[model samples]
Target chain A: MSTSQDFPTRKSSWKRFDVTVLYVFDLLGTFAFAVSGAIAAVRKKMDLYGILVLATVTAVGGGTIRDVLVGRVPPFIFRDITYFFVSITAGLLVFFFHKYVERRFKLLLIMDAIGLGTFTVIGISVGLKFDIGYFGAVFLGVMTATAGGMMRDVLQGEVPLVLQREIYASACIAGGLIFVCLDILNIVPDINVFISAAAVIAIRMISITKNWNLPKPKI
Target chain B: MSTSQDFPTRKSSWKRFDVTVLYVFDLLGTFAFAVSGAIAAVRKKMDLYGILVLATVTAVGGGTIRDVLVGRVPPFIFRDITYFFVSITAGLLVFFFHKYVERRFKLLLIMDAIGLGTFTVIGISVGLKFDIGYFGAVFLGVMTATAGGMMRDVLQGEVPLVLQREIYASACIAGGLIFVCLDILNIVPDINVFISAAAVIAIRMISITKNWNLPKPKI
Candidate 1:
């Protein structure tokens, strides 16, 4: 079968596959966030330009903030431009077919959960590439997962759900911590990514199904 | 009087004086923004930590974003740390004596006007150092003047005043455009700064006194 001779080529191909998967997940996450943002803008009765602005910001805002903090100039979206197009496409789709999209609320939540997990891992990976410590990496992860939603709420003149009583950011934090711990233990990078992302997705899904929430201050 | 020989020395000393005055104005602006943020946080019944966070963000957020966009790593505040101390001091004072500060609201508004003008000119100067062009410079100028207040308002779960009917951002835009025009005419840098800042302060003050507002959408 020539298994020994093909080992190096197979390993390289596997690496490429892993990268491709991460990239796909990142785009999916952007689309989901953009859709949510467009929905919010529509609910606010904002004009078409406003809807597009909100969607683009909600999709790329967190990552942009993360990149700026980690000293990445111009941000990744500025360079690639695909994220901008994806967000615009999502916004337009929702603007035209909002009722249909709203009918699939359950599906949207699932997609959002997937996005949160993927974004957290991506943020942590980026942070770890810098001199920021593990704590900073985890912070970047949680910020990447939640900041976009916060920006959306803030733009709409509402307190952020994450700051109020959502289990959303907590799930991201847990997943980020797990990723860091596994990385510290010298786990395989690919396996570590899968396990951490899965953990976040699981936590988020369970919380949604169980109607879980973080405790609110009794002011 | 040896006027010819003294001309070069006077010019150099005048340059130093201009820089020092700008630095002082920057600090004053930071202090003013921090006090405003602290006031907002108190109104929202946020805790001490929340007050501190809001104050710091209000004072530095615009400058930090500007630095990041211009590819400055770690940001100027991180390196100097003076801005941090200035914000903390302002926050602490407001937390303790907010009633007194509130009573002197007119003085606060004047200080804020000065800050708006200074920040706008500073942002434009920074942007001009990059390859982002004249329009980008003006945009950065307006952004630097208004973004901190926007952040403050957003954190308090309110629509940003700059984005509302306020004439605040318009004043900044005018000041920025004036700065660009004067620079293009080869006006002296010091005189350009003074004229641009005066234009902003005048526009803001006149608007306040006349209770001016931008027209609202009739939707």
Candidate 2:
């Protein structure tokens, strides 16, 4: 392992994205996921505490798992208070205005896609930092992008959405592959992150609009 | 943090139990949990692959989460080939003998309780080694005892049994407290672990036999 002095050199090409910028994207993704969780909670008519727990878990659960798998102790969510507040705020907003938000399902889907894209980029970057192999990195990326909503669906007594025929996790995997390829080719750091995230978002949007799905196994 | 020469002192006193003993109990617990998961998959009428997947996850899921929280990467199940084989064997057994097992639900419940007890002990010991505080240790213990079953229930599209009226998690918590207190009082390590695990098993058995339940929340 290299010392802090060698940290910059050791970091991948995606490292150039400023921490502040990454933090902002993280919060945006968190908020979007939290709202998705809150909407599910409302549909179940869960109490306030249940809604908040679901929202918080949906926002940070995947990242927590990612951090743990990469041997990062005391996950980022514990270190930063902002993530907690953002998730709670999103939950509160949805709780108070769920009927209005419910009518704007397309808007929610768009926000979720944005969250998925950004989270995939973040997961890839973090996984690369841990120096896990490309396959492990891509697996982590897909896990980060999909685990939260999958958890939410499971908690609500349904098969995970990711496990069903959907382009959701596939989009994240696509973004991860793009990021890994770009980094390997020594692309500019900011461009690598942007292109990867954009790819995920674009794919998600296109799939939703086109009603795209992976072929299902016929029993 | 210590050198290999100081490894023994760094290890908890509970480490006196040889790897063989620990491995045996771990495999036993894994088998029990795997059978439980297979039963759930059978109820859902999932395919053979789904049944195996559910069984594998249910056998190792709680321990995986516990390991992650303590910054132990590449969980114990991955290191031990026996755990994997035990779980798969159990799942296959259930797949073939599900009707017989279903008719003997009491036996299945007993096996599950044994798994729960042993897992709680393992979680507490690992958490303490990580120096996470007694509260966190107990929480980990309860989580380790319950989370796999909870995940299985959720994956099968049901409210988690732990979340409903059952003395399941409470027994684990109680056992954790006992272990912590005994350790603080300088009790012999092996005895402490035995007592703690036995307490959990006893409590769980009594609860089942007595029809004990925690009061449900008023909806």
Which candidate tops lDDT?
A: 1
Candidate 2 runs further than 4 Å off: A1-56, A69-74, A77-150, A158-219, B1-24, B68-73, B154-159, B214-217
Interface RMSD of each: 5.2, 5.4
Displacement of residue B203 (Cα, Å) in model 2 is 3.0
Residue-by-residue lDDT tens digits, candidate 2, B1-219:
111111113345556454345455656778888998998899899989888988988988898878777777667766666667887898888889888877888777787888888888788777677776676677677777777887898788786666445678778878998998998998765567678888998999999999887543232
Clashes of each: 0, 0
TM-score quality measure for candidate 1: 0.59
Superposition error at B131 for model 2 (Å): 3.7
Task: List model 2's recovered fraction of native interface contacts, to 2 decimals.
Answer: 0.27
Across A36-105, the per-residue lDDT of candidate 1 in tens digits comes to: 9988877876655556657877888898888878777656664565787888899888878888887899
TM-score of chain A of 2: 0.90
